[model samples]
Target: MVQINFAQKQVNAKIVYYGPGMSGKTTNLEVIHQRAPEPNRGDLTSISTDGDRTLFFDFMPLDLGTVAGMRTCFQVYTVPGQVYYNSTRKLVLQGVDGVIFVADSSPDMMEENLESLRNLQENLSEYGRSSEEIPLVIQYNKRDIPGALPIEVLEEKLNQRGAPAFEAIANTGQGVFPTLKALAAAVLDSLHKSSGSSVPASAPAAQPVAAPQAATAQPSAPAPAAAPAPQRQTISMSQTGFHKAPSLPLQGAAAPSEAQAPDKGARPPQNAATTPGPQALGGLQLKGGSEGDGGGLRMAQPATPPAPEQPPTQPSLSMAVPPQPPAAAPAPTQAPPATATATAKPQTPPANRPATPGSMMRPDGGSPPPRRAPASKSFPSKVQEAHATPKGGKPKSAALTVLIVVASIGLGAALGSFVLQIL
Candidate 1:
C-alpha cells in the first residue's frame, strides 16, 4: 500500500527483519545503523511496555543511490521477537516491500526459527500478501557462534527453492550489508520490471505537510506523452505457480511522513492514529486483513471464497533476470596422427557435408586417379566354362591375366632394345 513517487525520482522500499525472540533481529538493525554512513542512516528507536522487552518495532532509513534517476531509500524495521506479540508481528508485515527472515544459527534455536518462519507465511497469507512474490532474503544470524549448523542444512530446511541466503554475524557486521544490498536490489529491480522503468525505483523526497485524505492520494500529474507504456508484459499467474493476493487499497506512500523528515531527533508519536473505513467491493476480509484488526478496533465480515475456477493469477516474485551461467574452460584439441599410412584411415566426414562436384582430394594436394570400373571378366556361360577345364580337371588358371602380363613384358623389352641401338 506504500506509494513511491516516480515523478520526484524517489522510491521508498520496506524491508523487515523478522525472526523469533533473541534471534538477533534487533541486533542486526543496530549493527546496520552503526556501520552505515551517517548520511544514509537515521536514529534507532524502540518501544517497550511493562518490561516485557521491546514490543512494537524499530526503524531506520538508508539512502541507496539513484536507480535509473530516482533516489532510492530503504526503510528497515524489526518486528517484536516475543511470542506474546503475535498480533503485533502480523500488524507490522502489512505493505512489506521485502523480507529478511533472520534465523538464529544456534543449534538449540532451530525450532524457534522454524516456528518464526511458519508464522511469517501465515501472517503473509492473512494479510493477503503472497509470501513467494515478496522480495525475500534469508539471513542466518549469529553464524559466528561455535557449534552452529552448516549453512547447507539451514538452506535445505528453510530455503527450498534456493532464495538468496546469507551468513551474518550481525554483531560484527559480517554479511549484513550484503543481505541489505541483495534485498534492496531485488525490490528495485522488481519494481522497475513491473513499472517498465529504465532505472530502479527510488524513495521520494520527504513531502511537505498535507491533509490526511490528500496524504493517501498519488500526486496528480500527467505522464510524459513521449514515453510509451511498456510493451513487454509479465507472465500471468495462470501460467505460473504463484497465487495472487487481492491488492490492498492505497494507504499513505511510505511509512507516515513522521518516520522520514528533517528532524532526526524527533520521537515517534505515542501511537499512530488509525481510523477504520468500510471494506472495498470484491476484497475479502481475512485475519490481519485490516489495519484496525490488529488492535480489535473493529471486526469486519468473514471472507468469501474468490470466484470459482478462475483463481486470481498471482504476480511473479522470482525475478527472471537473465541468469549467468558458470564460466566454461576451453576444450582441449586432439593432435593429428604423426604420420599417415593406407590403414591410417581418414576420419569420417561431418554429418552435415554437402556433395561436391568432384571426388575429395588427399591431404598432399594430389588428385587421386579417377576410380575405374573393377576389372571383372564375365564367362560366356556357366556350362561353357565347365567344359573349358583342362584334362586334369583343373580349370585354366587366370589365362587372361597371364597373357596381359606377357604382352606388357615384350613391349618393355622391345622399347629398351630400340633405345640401345639408337645410342
Candidate 2:
C-alpha cells in the first residue's frame, strides 16, 4: 500500500488504469508520462510475456502542485490488459485510491470491455472496496479510429455504477492530460476533504506540495475559477461523432464555464488527437469524510452524505489500515527452583536373603526376581566379533572373513549336526 506522510506534508495516492487487453492502457501511461512535467513523473516500466503484455503494472508518478500547504503526488498504474492475467490485475488494485477504466472504443470490443468491468468489480470487492466509494474515472480510448462505438453505448454498459468517464485518444495526448488532471484533482480533493478544512482549494495552480510538504502559501481566498475550475482546451466536433455541431472556436484564453461540461463517457481516445479531455468527469461528487470539517481526525468523522442528485453506491477504492500486530503477550514467570529434597538413603538388602533359582536380591530391601529383558538379535554378537579382529592385517582380516563364512555354514550345519549329537 502507498503511504502519504502527512508529517512531511505530502499526500500520495494510487490511480490505476484498468480495462480489456490492447485497450490502450499502456498508451495512456505512455502519454501521461511524456506530457507530465518531467520532474513530476517517474520512469515507465513494462513486462511482456507470451501470455500477457504486462508482467507487472506500469508506474508513473505525477506531481500535482500542492494542496493545503502539502505536496501531493499521484502514482498512475495500468493493470495487465490480458484477460488471463486477472490475478495480477487484482493485486495491482489492492490499494488503489482511484481508477481509470481505459475501454476499447471499437464496437467489436464491447464484450471484452464488459468482461473487464466485471473483473474489476470482483477484484475490488475481494479487497473490500466497491467501485462506488473510490474516485473512479473512465477513458474510452481510440476515439481517433473510424469504427469507434458510440460513447453513450459504452457508458450504458460500463458505467452502470455511475463514476466519471472520459473520451480520449491516449496515443497523441488528446484527452490524456485532462483525464490525468481530473483524476489527480479528484484524488487530491478526496485527500483534502478527508483531511478537513485546512486544505486550500486553489493549491492546484500553486507551488508543488513538493516531495510531500514544504509549500509556500499566503492563505488567500480560493481562486475565483478554483472551486469547480474547468481545465480548458480546443476541440473539433467531428471527433465526437457529431455530424454538424460546429467546431468550438478557439478562444484566446477563456476557461470552461460550469455549463460547458462534456457528455458522459467510459473510455479514452485510442490515438494521438490532442483534443481537450472531458470536463464532465470532474462533476462527480464524492462523499465527504473530513476536509469539510474545520479540521478533524479521519477516524472521528463520518463520511458526508451523498449529494441528493447522485445516489450512493459502493466505493470502488477504499483504504484499510493494515491490521496492527497484536500486542506481545506477557512473558511467563519462572517458578523458584525446587528445593533439594533429602532422598532417603536406599536401604541395603539383608545379607541372609535367600537366592531363588531365577532371582537375585536387590540393593534395596525388596527381594524381587530378576526380570530377563527380551532377547536382542544375534547380529550384535557378530558385529562385536568383527570389530574384535586383531591388528595383524592379513591374518586378522582373513580370519574375520573366514569366521563370517564359517559362522554362516555352522549356523546351517548346527541345525542338522547338533540334532544328531543331541539324539
Q: Give the number of the best model, judged by lDDT.
A: 2
By summed lDDT, the worst window of 10 consecutive residues in model 2 runs over 370-379
Candidate 1's C-alpha lDDT? 0.47
Q: Cα miss at 412, model 1 (Å)? A: 99
Best by TM-score: 2
Query: Which residue runs does candidate 2 get wrong by more than 4 Å?
Result: 50-52, 65-68, 192-423
Over all chains combined, what TM-score does candidate 2 have?
0.49
lDDT of 1 at 231: 18
lDDT per residue as tens, model 1, 1-423: 334897888888888989888676765675565446556665444433322134677666778677568887888888987888899899889889888888887788788888998999899999887777776767776654556787766766876534556665443334455566556655655565444346523432111111122211121111222111111111111111111111111122122211112111011111111211111111112111111112110111212332212212211111222334434312111112221111111111122222212212211122111111001111111222323434433434567668889999999999999999999
Task: Give all candidate RMSDs, comma-separated.
Answer: 32.0, 32.3
TM-scores of the candidates are 0.46, 0.49
Global CA lDDT computed for model 2 = 0.48
lDDT of each: 0.47, 0.48
How close to the true structure is residue 407 of candidate 1, measured as C-alpha lDDT? 97
| Residue clash pairs of candidate 1 | 10-202, 10-203, 10-204, 11-202, 11-203, 12-203, 68-199, 244-314
Backbone clash numbers for all candidates listed: 8, 32
- The residue-by-residue lDDT of candidate 2 on 140-165, one tens digit each, is 77665555777667766876654445
